[model samples]
Target: MDFIPEALNKKPEVLLIYTQRMIRGRTFEMIENLGILTLAAQLNANGFEAKAYTGITTDAVKTIKNMKDRLFAVCFYCDFDNQSAVAAIISYLKKHYHFYVVLGGPQTLHMTEKDLGSFQADGILKGEGEETLLTWLNAKIRGEAVLVPGEIQPAQNADYIYLEDFSKYALPRNEDVLDYHERPLLSVITARGCPYRCAFCFEGGNSKNLRMRTAKDVLDEIEARLKRSQRPRYLFFCDDTFTTNPVRLRKILSGVKRLREKYDFVWFCEGHPGFLVKHLEFIREMIDSGMVRMQIGMESGVDDVLKAYGKQASPEDIKKVVEICYAAGLPQLTGNYIIGGAFETAETLATTTRKALELLDLAPGMLDLSTTFIMPLPGTQIYNQPEKFGIVLEDRECLTNLEDFPVNHTKELSLPEVCMGRSRFITAVSNKMKEQYEHGLITKERIQADFKLAFNYGIAAGYLKFIYGKNNLMVEYYKKLIDYQGLLKEWHELSEQEKNTWVIQRIPDFSLFDINTLSQLEIDILAGAGSDTIGETAEKLSLSAEKIGVLLKGLSDRYFVLFSPFI
Candidate 1:
């Protein structure tokens, strides 16, 4: 259904706020602004004046207050980097603004109505918020009692609350409300939910039920995005597994090719080894269709560690998949490795480290090492059996911030050993990979830079091992910086032919934006384009000279458009 923007009389005022890391921070390179923007579009279509307020500082909120009169406010809270900032906003809205504040997202889904009351939210939209939020808002527009589907119907006597399917309703124009500031990338969600069970995981721990969109449905979304967005340059498929079924993956790859021929975009998504080997041909097709990268969840290379985490695939399975991806020209692949999970001992951790080294040497892409500590979430099996895992249940305060606690402790290894091992492995493998790449051991520069990042990352890993153990900011920072550096080096080194081998390399992911937030420009220089004159690009894009000047200045600062020649 086409969403018509209703005026003040016809529509109810709806304000959507996204104060999470996606809008505010630079630590994570994400695609979707979670589901907040998508829910906002749904509200807008249902005769609600929806506007997204992101990374709103105190001054920014004051300015927004002056701009729009509010009726209801919605905030998506997913354990954001800045919870205090978002909590303050929520507090302000309820106490001063007198707005009906609805908190939705992963954090809300984890907490019951009582647990979420601490956030001071009037109501929490559990599960998928699209239908529930829209229903609640539409009812509010008519001055009806706000009741969310499967919402723990506020009652005197209730044993348990059953969640409802909010996905069945007409999804909002997520593409419409998605304000990219005319950036190069477009966020694409091909499917929802995962099929695996990883005990430490909080996102998919709630359920292992995989739900996919029809190939046609996904292709339609791509086509719509190609027409509506900035040429559909880059797509980040938010699906947990993009290659679960070979036949479906093949069909989607075929569709992606059809779209790529016209729109010319690249995409990336997460996958597992079990799916990759079964769909080798589709993997190749994915590469041909501009699928540049795969974020494979190779939690641990040790067979024992794999079994402990309920990862069905073994080290051999991962090796085979990584090798296949390399052959298919999917050169930028990253693996997620968990360090401090239940049943993880010092010896098992060492085996994981050694396994990572072995895999890094054999694989072709960049390997991202994630060393996450296991945390008991609300619905996961680990939460029910804390004693079985040797976790101290009495220490509730430790569990409050997952970053500070080690949820799983085994007798074989001290907490520090498990944590330090993760740091050591992340550092060692990363630096070794990069050092080999820098020394011309790898033919692909992108692959080389990916490894090169590990060198700098090792320094951070060393620090993490000393200070904050696993999943520390220093470790993460090292990984990100190394990745960025590697990306830049790859961007500079890859030839047009080599670059064309993968979809990600064909199109640029980063963009040039002005300080005023009024303008955004494609900073990606076309093949053979000289850096002699910035004015030429301004003319090509039909942009004003002033705008072009601003863009060039920004690009230069960001090192996107460099003046230096290759030695």
Candidate 2:
């Protein structure tokens, strides 16, 4: 809104609305809507005065009312959850405003003519919208007839926009939506489409061609981001498969490594198992270049389940990639699995659970796991023909809720059975973590960290109580985490030599001892007194030197603190 100039007599020609759904619980993690911004940039380049609204805010409505007769184009990029909001906005605009309403993005690809009629949109632009929208607008401006999808042209090939230089457009900043600590996390997209055609994925069916930006172009965008206000500390690459092309990946990593030295920041990305395994050396280079986390799509653990879903990787391939990432010093690796696919059965679910546990056992404290039920999104094979996969499509609305168990039931398994299988898998992984903690394979700190990660995801899915019992486990773990933080605070206040000693001794506990009751001399020694000798302190306190030495040794032994002469 601040970017729009009020002194101009003429009203803007276009208003782009980037609609986003209200994330039920995870409000702290909302990402900026970048698609609409890209469209705005394209329209501006073609001599159109285009302004963008992230959502249908009060300011947006006022701006539209003021320019009621002057506006020509109003475009909306909506997703599944936000379709209702977009419809309401479009209905209101049609009643009062004169501009043509255009609906685009993934949500529109599946909508039938009946659905489009409900919104009362003047035109429908499906698939990638930039080129279609621009061409339509140019024709309208020239007083020429403009044909849109659902009326004259097919939605699939409505002039998909693949920019040769993606960097020409300015990306979204969205600093207001971020939390205090999250201000530094910026999102950047290096590629447009995915190469793999996994049957369960909407991207595979929607993208006709895979395109990527040059590594130098991407690096230049990053450098520009660094110069902006509130400099970012992390870059989240929003690509579907960041490592799709190995040659480009290497050039990006090499450039990032050079830039990282000048501007200190880390990054997280999405990767595929096949690419990660084939390029271990590149993974290492990525780690060195501040790639701290990766989310890998290991859709299923059973080979049959994977093959049915058109996933090229096997269970063994997933395991190998996990092993390699852990060895490369990657701090966090998230293995994502989709249960209840076309070939999903009780047996396959069990195999998947076993594989998940095996991966957890492979790296006790490093790897993280996430499992979600498969949703038959529109344009995918499963959605078009449910009977071929032995599934019955009951309610299309259920597609909006992919985080939960599959709402539709397969011929081999009922709805209850599907829910049970998913619950069992989550419990099994959690129990395995508890078992490791009990056996001392992993510390309580590691268990707490893993649970925190799980809790965040559970909250997002609105299933925290269902997955982990009615807040009891969460409450108990939170108390333990608090206690650990208290101990860590005291540990951090110690001298460098004392801190080294604690690490060398595996972080011994001194919390049981009461510091308040100790004499001043005893407290000084414990606090690493600068120059006070044990003998002089003993003489000053009227205790024998032998007695003081024994006391010091006893304290060290009890706390597991090793005394190093080199310090």
Candidate 3:
């Protein structure tokens, strides 16, 4: 009656290594290395003693050293940013241990044998690794020769293996490998591969086919996970496009609604604007089914830019979808934007900024915006044929380094120009929000939440600037905000006109200045600065002399304004 295989206890062990990477200063998504955990689960099910080390503790080397004799294979779930770490680990294993080393994941797909040689790994698993890994391990266990697609050695059996039905594989359990006992969020994948061809996306562009699990299968997995975690805080659907198939999505929502009645949990998923608009009722159903948030990839707000990037929806489509979601009473909506893409010009960037502002205006307190420069990942059209997009690739090694913006030059803009443009766009959005706050359009609580979101963007843009060899003005501004909290509080207490003069005199760079600091009255005051006296300047601008005198005194103290001593 025992489920454990007798052979597994006797077989040599396998070690799966997963290193963490940060995205947008958030590690919530990376907490569980799902791919490796799924591989380990399959290995265990197939009568192999597999253990995983998720870099939670620095015991990988000690574990490997202790089990050197029993360790048969060392598998690494590689990431673009962790190439050096992977190489270091592989080199150490090769130098001391004799186990077969296997490299897999998106990073392996783009690397050549020469590029991989330094790591001294025995083989690499290209494409989906589940079936290939299970097949190779089974062959190895059976004392038969195995061949990997990109390896130097060839086996007698060279056929590739892929799981036709995704449901056959067991759902990954995060508690098995990840330190998820205390974590509130758990990520689950309902599907594999994306059908769309996004030029800036390596994953979607390289996805040969779309494969999905049935609603029953997904719901069963969710129910099991909830039972294990005792209903975790949130369930994140990590599918590339959760609503790509409306029929399947509706079925899934119905099952989720049934589950929600029994469990106290909320869920989040990613969706496209086209699908969101097409399936309005489904979105409402999802919200009713405890779907708290949906992240939409509205890549750009310019129609031409979206078309050039092969996006399915236009700016109008995105706005309409946002309006629909608002009408549907969705709790929170997050929109992702890519700034520098093919055919992007100053006018297009402005149009995009304006459109993004319009979206913000639509959902003043509900919308969360994330903006970034387009990265040309390997295997994408932009990467394979850079000349077509007028892109000049720089630092191929850094393609996977998403923390800092990757280096590339478009025909229309250089890397620095792109970085600056991205910063300006984010600043513009922040200013608009600030303006709303100043005019009493939005609550202080809303402004504070908006500031937090804008701060994250500032940190990202500042890192990008540092990468692009520009002064990290955004970073400095962030420091100023933290260091000058008292000064800012005092500045906020000043009348709207005084605050404007303070900002204009202190922060001369318009791009860096918060536009909300400048009111129409302040603009008029500046326009009438050539008058002989404060009274005349105030009269000219239709403002009181007392107000002008206060602004003039503040500016003079900062050496920004001067008065005629003879007068």
Candidate 4:
């Protein structure tokens, strides 16, 4: 059952399951994912043979088997988008190979003890898996019993471990890292943790104290990546907050400005809206220096909800940041709003939605409304005071269902209402953003193709929803695809002559084929294989102007294989 060579017998073979979304259109592959890959490489370098499974590869079974029967299993349960898929895989793996499962990332780290029980995972790495996981793996390799941070109980006399520092590990190397295409954006982590204590966020609680690499460290990594490839289209800063410290961010930006003069590519990262406003000049400099997009977690429109979530900022802060971004000549700026919260009533939800729409009108930037369901995770105040907020964490399985349920409830809104309102808000905001992008309210100086891909997926999703009732498959089918920025490029780059319209025909090859409402003939016509005019399409579908309008709107939005209507 052992696969390691005799020379490496002392070193344990570890299987790190890196699950990714299956749908290609809906997912946006963030930079943080690279951290796990880097972690794997680090373990390999230390003598433990580590292999990663993205879960989308065709040979996933073989890949898992190659690493199976290893001394330990560390599953990097990173993205919450496909926890069910990961859960299924974990269940199957454990059933076959009784390996120790270690879970981390936003989803796993945030799991309620009950939810953790459901995951049936042996242990949970509470925060910052770098030091925690490395210590555990090292202990196991040496045949010392290992106990992870936050492990409730370990086998008798197990080796207990925790990381006192994160700086000891070098920034991960970017060479030979594969994306969906051979040329997917290079992801780099310059920093970790955020100063803000927003209640709605489960991701940033990993560290109370934020740490960042030196400007030289960041630039060195970028320079190494550039040496590997002449200028990949984008560099993603997967840090929780890249610009928390204006001076350091500016230093990185200044370094990038020099690089862009020669490389001429784009970069993006998340930020606090308040920070962006306070550092408007630096933001403008960053944009000019080729930082194309800045994402802000402006979680609520109502001032009360902002306070309730401990956001420590106002809607005015959101307004100021957006206005500054628009004025800074930044091509794209994205702001997030949480629809349901302690202060959110249906009426308040409406107010937040109204304020969001107004912000879009006033600021002239893209707007995105995040999931309303309040996700309660471990290490946060929300986990301990679930009763204070009417949130009960039933079990470890709750983490898998966070995207669907509100682990925490507010007096103002019921869970169902929050979910519904959130969906509606998402629809409204996406529609408004698409209109703004189409009307040229926001300029896309960088990653125009990526935006176009997102735009098309939105259109397709809208059309599908309009035609078929709003179903989970329809929603998940699109969300999964859009998140997979790397994988989409693989489907797209199959041939140079291949057009985007081919998705109408080719999408069936993937898992989403189950949700396709269009018949085989319709798919062929929609895919541009057969001659089907808009009128013919309308007639064949025999739907109302509303339905036809939805389809046309989606197609025009970038869903169809037709020319870019926005362009």
lDDT of each: 0.57, 0.64, 0.65, 0.57
Per-model TM-score on C-alpha atoms? 0.70, 0.72, 0.71, 0.67
Give candidate 2 regions above 4 Å deviation.
1-15, 20-29, 44-74, 96-100, 110-116, 134-182, 397-402, 434-567
Model 2, residue 300: what's the lDDT? 78
Would you give me the overall lDDT of model 4? 0.57
- Candidate 1: global Cα-lDDT? 0.57
The residue pairs in collision within model 1 are 430-454, 434-451, 434-452
Which is the leading candidate under lDDT?
3
Which ten-residue region of model 1 has the weakest summed lDDT? 500-509
Question: Candidate 2 on 350-461: residue-level lDDT in tens?
Answer: 8888889899888766666777766777777787777776676666556345345566777778877888888888889878866764465754344344444343222121
lDDT of 3: 0.65
Clashes of each: 3, 0, 0, 24
Q: Candidate 1's residue-wise lDDT over 51-143, tens digit each?
A: 655553554466446643434445544453445555666766666555566766665545554545567776666667676777766665566
Give the residue spans of candidate 4 off by over 4 A. Answer: 1-13, 20-32, 56-62, 66-91, 98-167, 174-181, 203-206, 363-372, 386-409, 430-567
- Please identify which of the two predictions, 1 or 2, would achieve the higher lDDT against the true structure: 2
For every candidate structure, what is the RMSD over all alpha carbons to the true structure, in angstroms?
12.6, 7.6, 12.1, 10.9
Kindly indicate the candidate among 1 and 3 with the higher TM-score: 3
